[model samples]
Target chain A: MPQELFNKPVTELSGMLARGEVSAVELMRSVAERTRKVEPKVHAFNSLDEEDALAQAAASDARRAAAKASGAEVHALEGIPIGIKDVISVAGQPLTASSRMLATFVSPYDATVTTKLKAAGAICWGRLNLDEFAMGSSTENSAFGVTSNPYDLERVPGGSSGGSAASVAAGEAIASLGSDTGGSIRQPAALCNIVGLKPSYGRVSRYGLIAFASSLDQIGPFARSVDDAATVLGAISGHDRRDSTSLRMEVPDYRRGMDELRKSGRKWRLGIPKEYFGEGLDPEVGAAVQAAIAEYTKLGCEVREVSLPHTKYAVGAYYIIATAECSSNLARFDGVRYGHRSKDATDALDLYFKSRAEGFGPEVKRRIILGTYVLSSGYYDAYYLRAQKVRTLIRRDFLEAYKQVDAIVTPTSPTPAFRKGEKAANPLAMYLNDIYTIGVNLAGLPGISIPCGFTGGGLPIGLQIIGQPFKETELLAVARSYEERNDWRNRFPTL
Target chain B: MPKPEDFNLDHVANLARINLTAEEKTRFSSQLGDVLTYIAQLNEVNVDGVEPTAHAFPVVNVWADDVAEAGLPVEDALRNAPEKRDNMFVVPKVVE
Candidate 1:
């Protein structure tokens, strides 16, 4: 079994494949076996197209062999395996936003992100489960089932990218791609104890990713190492004609930044946001994060108190903007033009009502109602308009704070992964879970959560590094410095 | 803070196009109402005269040209609908 391949970084695996240490088919099976062994406990997949994945792997191997034979340059991602979030499109594969409405639906074409991955020689191993349509904080809203936290089976892995996070955390996949809209990726990364990066909003294309909040959604990587994350981001980051919002600039060589940091002795200025480590945080997790910060200080980096006054308004602004976009984006699924329609209906109105009624889950319905309420004609001036105003203020606050500081720090989550039903009973508690991370998404800056420490219960705590827009390289430098000092990459949950 | 009782479950259900029993409505109303009230605390923030932002960082005119490049064929697009009756998306006729 190539299962030893499971623990290697994606770059190492890619190098092994090129050197014939293991074939693509061999690596694919190794991951498949691991997925089979651990997925029942993790509940990470919405759909696992094993046959397709292996076939793609075989093709990638053939291409690499052919390229090597011909002395031609091979695709950097040859034979690499990636887990796609359910929210991203995978051609000829099911693209259920985890909603029952799209339960049986398959995407006709690949999203721009998928296209890039395929072109770069990576194989899409499976579709990870997510909160239906990327709505909820936990994968509990998944039409299929909730993904249990790998750290503790009965607890939730933070979501709606929970499956993506858990899959990577549990070694189901070497790397998985997830979309972050208001902390979807970072929060789950914290809970699952993986490195999750929310790229600057336009750093990656949003064309193929199902819209959660159009403005905030950005595709990013969840991997075990900072370099692995950088490698995958390099493969997927580029401009696309399909997504107008895709950045026009050339993708920076994020790996090169690592070399620069190494040469410069890895010194970084850390900014600890006084606003973040306030009262509501779990003290154990707070100690872990502060400990991580203290290491940065001891390493010759200055730690200063930075204030982001408007950090308070992020969740509020995010919900309103995200909801309004969701309200508009989801309007197309009115049983008239889409995947699910009511079985029996006397009229069109009844059909629209019954179809949506039966298809959407409680959370989806809740977000839809909230979005509709905010965007509805009469109340738009009050709710939607006001939220937009607050959104601006949130962005300005981040810009203002970044001027005084190089990067802002936060506890990736307020608490460690909680029991499955612990906060399931209350939506507010669930939203509060994302408080530390959402502000970054609201400001459209890049943020990453790397496991810094652990709780007494053994769950991991994440240290967040928030950077100015497109400063992913800098953010990862800080993360890598800490990761090197006290490597959390080798830490594993005893399943 | 947002009003909890003001959200009759009927309004939420109607807006969301969901069928709800009285018990479900009662449960969801309190649940959703609590969620909204917590979220509404942002209003007290003195965002007065401060412009509300729609996207993070700076993005200007990030739209593609309106020219038709290429897209999936309609046949492929319709492949996922659980039910489709015509070239167009067909639903129960409600216009009378």
Candidate 2:
């Protein structure tokens, strides 16, 4: 296996493919070899069909060869190997979402993101692990198993996009797609030491994405570099008639934004949200994030202290809203349609009970029950309605802060990756893991987490830079400035 | 915050359509109680006049033309059906 090829970013790999120095088949083979070697230790993939991946790679190579002969250019992501979160449908692949409910389910149509990746000539690798229906913070909720951090085998790769970040960090995949409802993408990227972006809600279509909380879910990219993240976002984002909520905005050339920002040498005013730095924040993680903020100052960026007054209500409001939406969305998975069916069921209602009871894992069931409680009679006004009102306040807080800052900075997670099962016993403790990151989702802003530095234990710390809605270009540029100045992104796990 | 005794686990589970065993029901009762206690902090906030935000962005009536487009073929749509009959999902008999 070629370590050099495995480590090369998509930009470099694309250049090699265009220059005819490397064939798409060769890149796929290298990745396949790497996946075979590291996957056992990391448990990053739920399932992989190597033969299919190789076949796609071969087609990409032939297409590139034909384009070169005709003096035409290939697609932007031609020959890049991309792994997709299992929740996102890729036609003909098992879309389990790391749950027994959909364990045998196969997608009939590609997700908008998957279709875009294939159109751009990227090889789609499916069945990456996630929290069952993207419910839990840690991948332990995955029915398949936990995806361990590549940096440390005992620690979790932050999830529900754990495998998405871990595979990219461990060199199993060049780039991967993960959906962020709360802090799924960014937290995992922070833990795995990679770049993860959650575009503004509706920036990307969710037609084929297994809906968790449709209002908050945004499929984004995880990569080794900010540039790669931007490239993948550009490819996947755009309006789709199939998804009525999808934004009807033009997708910007995010890759160009990086170079343009660099050439302009402009300064961005960044705000440090006061609430993020206090209470339950690990000292070492705080130090690393603060150091990254200081580096921004050195890079000619100004930092100001800003307060999101309603920050405390974010976690409660998020759970209320997310789970309520999830209860409705996941109801479609009853045994009759496409997911798991109960063999012992005697009637239609018995089938739903037995199937959902046996199919969904504990965390998912907990959420469904809680969501049901919140939306149930008599409780809806006190719980769900109040949470919605609080949600508005949280969103208003962000709107107020954006007036003073171009991007807001914080730690993507309260602490670095914790040992697997550490927070399993107490659901609230696990929910608190996303305290800093959840506020961004509730506000529906675009947020990116870039590897800032490492804790004393060698775990990665992620510095979150949040931007106003649809300002991912500025957000990425701010992240790029930090990523370029620091050598943190260059480090890879010993695995 | 409501005490653990305040919740009826069986009712909630029934509403969620999950049939939990005796042990799971007891465990979930406590766990759900703890989570609810934590979430009860939302009551501390003053949300008197704030409008609820259902969607992060405002969206309404995004209608496509009243014309049908090609949809998933019957075979493809039913490909993942766990049980089927006559090109339709086979569910347990509903009417007595």
Candidate 3:
């Protein structure tokens, strides 16, 4: 079978577009057709505008022609179609965040990352679904609908970036963007068998990203290959004055740096955190990650056992900190300004109460209440403050480990994608799904989930590579080393 | 450490300004109890002499030039408003 244009990575698609071998419109049509075919079963997108995508592609083609005539340099991502998770504003597009609260809301301006992608000449494609306000581990929490694992329709696409990961895995888009607050991006990418890179906190601007947990939230990319992820990361990263937390450091040429590092044949000192491979880890997933570590050992990299003692406390701290931030961030969703309003409201205060009651889903409400409680007067010191102090310990654990290792390798998720509704009833059970991935967020480190191997059941398993703060260059190179030696990136879902 | 059984669903919900249905209140009370119990494990860790990390890499004292820049036009800003009148969001009467 011929490789469809939709499945090609951004790196390859860019070369094709530059060579005039394939038109941007042709790629857009291929992606649109693929999305239309599989979207019913995958349910990865909340909304897509094919006509608008085609128009954007046409404009890209026109720019390419002009650049050719004028002997001007073309952007690296010119004409590539990338999906936007619904939480990020795309100016005039629906920014629902997969919640009923913003069911009818449209963004009035572009997110900083959106502006960056557009400037790179990429087509801002579909509005992908996510857990409402990015509060859950599975896409099932999304008010729009659950996004299914392309590998098995009965299973979930790990979330709250489930739609972003699913869309790429299903060839619905070349790549997509997702927000990672407590493993939203990496978990989904692991479940979907793709590469998801969560840059260090403040590495990517969060100016237009709908706040989930203000401190933990960082926007990242989901792509089929590590190289493509690098391409997307380069375009979207850097300082944005609009986002006060955005790092002011210079953005490196990641692809170039990755290539240079690869050529240098640098021997990486990889850490295997003992806590990550412990109880609750599926045997199959464990074997796959161990095999990946063995592969690193064979490649002449030093493998050492490192300890992140605070690992066990990550979930507890994350829920407290994230929910507390979310409770504050989501306060803007009251019916007073925009989003769904309660016609049943009688007075001003009643409006805030009823409108929120009607607009938010059960999980969102649960989180808000929990968050409010933690920040409430008496419990503040016990919960919120204690969580913050634990967070410091968590960050310190990683910093201590990095002293002995170039990067830490672990399982991206405890298990492969679970059957839909398996843990939906138990929020605590679902929270454990992100156990291995959340500590990276707490430490503000760059982490990538790449396909390591698959289970006997044919479900994909991910090997996570956690790098030092602001060290994405080394991280991508490390991930790329594993990717180059493995055939996992070549396989795709039959659906 | 606060126990899960002590979680006041009604009080918290009221503080959050969300009117949970009877069913939601019942379901969340139990569901969140499990979560709160899980969160209680944090108390086990000794945080003595540890400074709370509000942000992983806190960028302190971020200042921008105090110059007026372009703001969103009123029409565009009010575009998503559930109720709008003359380029302003119309909310339920608060003063009355």
Candidate 4:
């Protein structure tokens, strides 16, 4: 099958729309057709309404037409169709987070990210699948259906943003939005052979995103090219009063930053974190990432080895803090207000217990129990409080390294996408898949995963770039420098 | 690895408001035991005198204007309620 108009990058599509070459309705119809063709094999979307998408596309067309007649400016994403992870609310759409607890829950209002995307003229089309309540590393934990890797149907797409990555890899949408708590966006992007960025904590608003781990969760973009990701990030990022955690910083035009870095001819100091390359990393992935580093050197970027000494403790601290926050965040699904209710309940307490037990999935239940146990009277100081302190150490490690190097590079994941059910039986093994990416979240810094190369069996390898706090422009610039040197972004799965 | 026998699954389940079956309890007990064993490495870090970070950024007391805003309508608010009556979510009686 030929690549449809929907598979073009948002930049190209924007130019085409401006040049009167393609109507928004035509572009939307092509995407709808592509979704119908690829959905069965990849299972990327949770819910999609073609009628609603076309109506939105038509509205965008009318706005553009009026702008043209009045000689006014149109938004950057005037008619681009994007897939949204179900965790982010789009008003009037199902916000399930792939859990039965919100299986029938329709969002009453748009999330901050969704509102900004709509305001910038982006069409938030379908509800993408995710790990149930964004707890698991794989989408197999979703109650809806597991999203298959577009590269290989038998293997898992690295999650909990599996559907977000799979949709773009399968060319079902032009671009997509995903939330990363612990490598949710980057890991899946690497597995699917695409670009994914996790902006600095508080860089984007989180008002309408169904909270998993509040402090670490950030909504970002996934695209086939670095420019599209930058464009989308610029559109959705800014200060919002609704979320107190949102940063009070000015949003820069990130696409311009990418172009500026491409021409600056400046040598950036890149750090290779030695801890990330040792022991469990697959040999093929290490070699590919090392080669990517060499390409950076050839592009006049200085490379040196730097140590994030507390890297090992990152997973430990992340699990403790994330689960603790998740336990408190998800407590609202008690059947008193909305979501699934139990029929066997005799009293309020029974209703709470039965409704939660029936509504939550196994992984969610396990996290809730673990979180509750850690925060229990005797364990709080030893577990929850101790983890928080170690989290501070992890953040300090990154800060120390940033003084010596402009950015740190590591393999996004230890290995390529694993076969379905390979690590599902052991939760610890699944958690270790995020060993390389979780430290970025712990430090609350920006990180981007761009495809570097492929394995012998053709699975994609991702090289991650970690930046200083609120330095997404520099992060995306470094990513684009490496991106422009290779054709890796052009490769897509023939699903 | 921490001994799975040391943690009582039933007690924790009670605190979490989940009524797990015997099979689920056994499964979770062993799996969570593995995870807890892995996370036990945090004890090795020397975090003395470090202030615990609850939020990523430091923004204290972010106050908004007190003007009343148009909020979710009664119909939209109760749209997803499992049980509702008279435009309000209905729950079991808490008091006798």
Candidate 5:
């Protein structure tokens, strides 16, 4: 595969297709070859349907040719190859969510995002691995195996969108759609050296996404560059009748804001939330983020330190809220209705018991239990209720901080990806990796993570840009400017 | 922080309807204990008068209108089910 294709933004590729400079078949072939080559080392995908992907690409070319001949307005994403996280349902394809329970279960319908991608003429490659039910922060929780960060094979690719992030970074796919609940998308993007966006809760439809935390989960994009990320973002966003929580607000031309920001004489004012720069961040990542902020200073952007007083309690509030929702969403997986059923059981109750026993993994069971425990009648007020109250404060913190600053900058993750299995022993330590990101999700804000620099051992570091709700355009403006100045988007792993 | 022994995995597993073997059960207890111990850190933070939030943004009327939309066709929806006796999801007989 040529590095040119890897470096080209999706918009550029779309133009190439429109001008007959490249055919969809050729583009898909290049990426298909790359996916086969890198996936073994990176462990990025749970399923790879090469025949279907090629067919889809060939179909895209045929459609585009037909449209041009017929003088029809062409959809912008025609012929792009986008990887999808396994959890999202694509009609007639197996959607495992990287879990064994549904290893052989094929989806009966396409998820809202999947249908949108197909309609836009973007070919869907097989599903990518993730933490089971999107629970863990590291892809290590995947039942199959850990997804390695292509940047450094020894370290993790962050999860639960870890595979989605790594695949795009390694040039396996042009972009990917990933779910964000407590920073799953951004944290992984930060660790893998790519652009990952977490749309505000309800900004994008989640009808087809396998539920982890319904209230917090939103499907967003991970691409090699900010512009590519924005293209995919625009394609998948908009209200869907299938998802009740889907927003009906006008979908902005996300790319337009970047132009406005670039041409405007307005000064850049960025807030560095005090709590983000506090105690636990890795020194190297901190330095890299601060340097990135300083570069914005040269761009006529002013930086100021601000405080979000409720930051300390975000993790607690997140786990409580996320787990509580997880418990409810997962209730349907009772081994009877949909997927798994134990081979034999003494009774119906035993069937539900044994089938679920054999189906879900240990970590997933842990969450279900924890969620159930927290939401149980006895503990609801103390744990679940209090977490909800604090969740309000966490949201308020962002509103209050945004009142004083146009956008806020933080380390996408507290530290770079640790070695696989390093934090699994202590789930709390694993959860801590989300400290920098959980609040953004908690507050239903949009955030993006872009590679800023590297660690001492050559791992990637990311700087996060957070914007107020429905402000994805502004978020990308701050991100694209820094990305253009630095050109770190093309950085990739040797693997 | 909570003690390691505070959580009993067996009881939790029973509630979750998972039948873990003795060995698996033993392993889960310690792991669940660690997870709880970590979550216990949140107890120290004070969120007085704070309201618990369910959605990140306020999205009233997330529910679709009561429109009679077309649902999955019976044939297509039943294509994947290994065994179906009628136009519905099927399972082994629950009654003896």
Candidate 6:
């Protein structure tokens, strides 16, 4: 049986395009048709421009033809379709961060990642929905509307990159880009039963990513396979002069590196952090992760127990630091320059208050208020400063464990996708969804979540692999080892 | 550390430049109190001389060359402005 082009991975699609098996236009139409079929049910995209996507595909076909005629090399991602999270800017596209704040705004310049993707000859697909300002664990916080989990419409897809994950799982996209502040990318990928990678901070440029906890946020990929993720990562992982924080380091050919590592037959030292397996983790999710570890041992890998003592404080520390950064970064959305402007204001001061109150959703307002309180006079040291110091402790904990382990393994999320609105009313409960993944952001390390198995209820379970800083190549290789041995990556939601 | 009960919601809303309805104030005051109480657990960590980490891998003093390059055109720069006049964003009256 022939696989549907819409559901095929990037590696397969790229190969077909190179071999003249399919034109880029046909591939785009297949994906666009799939998106139209599933988007009404999944609501994965905030908006899409299929016409524009087809045009880009036509251009890719032309480029490939020219390359074939001249015997020139074509880029790895040529003719592939990739979705963009709403928070990342794509010039001439709607830049709504799933919020009314920028509901009417359009970007005038491409994000660094967007530019790189286009340069690699990929068609930038749609503006995928997210939690407004990427603040919540579920897409319920989005002002646009909730994006349903492709696996189960009643449950959330996990957020704030929920749509990014759901689209790929539903065959609406071949691959997608998402930004992880806490666990936006990995958590959603876990729930959707896909592969998501959060690159180490500074490893990827954040030039056009809407600031959300700037110190921790990193743009990453969500794909059907680890190999697909490596291809996307290689295109977007280089340093940019526009973003000073981007690391000035050499970008390796991650796909080639994965092959090299596999050929070397090297076994990795895997760490199982005891803190991640404690109370509150769903029993099935724990069993799946543990089974994955056992598989690693069978593959001749060394499995060890390591402790990250400061793990308990990750969520609390994350909220303080992330909110503080958000409150400051979001100040740019005032009515004066861009975003929503108040029609009910009496003066400038009144405009600021009314515009923000009207523009922001409840979660955004709650975070802004909390952030302002923490950074306010007399409370800065007690809250913000204290959290930063605690952050230091969290990073040290990962470093300490890294000395004994090549990579750490844990459940990507505590539970499978929960029913929509289950933890919506309580912010603290929602924040706990990122408990296992947030420490990686604090420690500035790369982490990848790969589908390990499914729950008895048929929901997916993800196994997270934490890698050393600036070591995504090794991380993807480690994740591929399990992926190659498992059939989980082959399954997709029947949308 | 200040008690979570002592959190001044109205004052914080004012600082954040966001208006809250009476209902919102009441709801948020209680909810945020729970979050703050949870955060109070940070005091349990012994950080006698530990330094704070603003960024996990800090890159200090990044300098670009003293050179000129094209920037966003005025038209593009003001493209998203809610209200604009002659390529400048228009805002509410400030001076009397």
Misplaced by over 4 Å in model 2 are: A1-3, B1-5
Model 6 CAPRI rating: high
Docking class of 2: medium
Separate DockQ for every predicted complex: 0.60, 0.79, 0.89, 0.70, 0.53, 0.88
Which lDDT tens digits does candidate 1 get at residues A1-495?
Answer: 233776667878978887888998999898899889988888899889899999999999889888988999976578888899998998889888888888777888898889989998998978999998998788898889899998899889988899999998888888999988878888889888889998887889888788878888899999988888988888888888767677787888888887797778855666787888887899998999889888888888878887778777777777778888987788777776666787877787777677787788878877887787777656676677777787777777788877777788789998988888787778777877888888888778899999887888889888889988888888888788788888676777777
- List TM-score per model, in order: 0.96, 0.98, 0.99, 0.98, 0.95, 0.99
True lDDT of residue A191, candidate 4? 93
Put down candidate 6 lDDT per residue, A32-134, tens digits, no spaces.
9999898999999999999999999999999999999999999878999999999999999999999999999899999999999999999999999999999
Assess the local accuracy of residue A434 in candidate 2 as a C-alpha lDDT between 0 and 100.
Answer: 92
Candidate 6, position A293, lDDT: 91
In the range A32-85, model 4's lDDT, one tens digit per residue, is 998999899999999998999999999999999999999999877899999999
Least lDDT summed over 10 consecutive residues: which range in candidate 4 chain A? A1-10
Task: Give every collision pair in model 2.
Answer: none
- Per-residue lDDT, model 3, residue A44, is 97
Error of model 4, residue A442, in angstroms:
1.3
DockQ for candidate 5: 0.53
Clashing pairs in 6: none
Q: Per DockQ, what order, best first? A: 3, 6, 2, 4, 1, 5
Against the unseen true structure, what C-alpha lDDT does each candidate score?
0.82, 0.90, 0.93, 0.90, 0.83, 0.94
Estimate, for each residue in A147-266, the C-alpha lDDT of model 2 and write its tens digit: 999999999998999999999999989999999999999999999999999999889999899999988999999998998999999999999998999989999998797789778988
Q: Give the TM-score (vs. native) of candidate 5.
A: 0.95
| Alpha-carbon RMSD of each model | 2.0, 1.3, 0.8, 1.3, 2.1, 0.9
Candidate 2 at residue A227, lDDT? 88
The reply for model 4, stretches above 4 Å from the true place, is B1-5
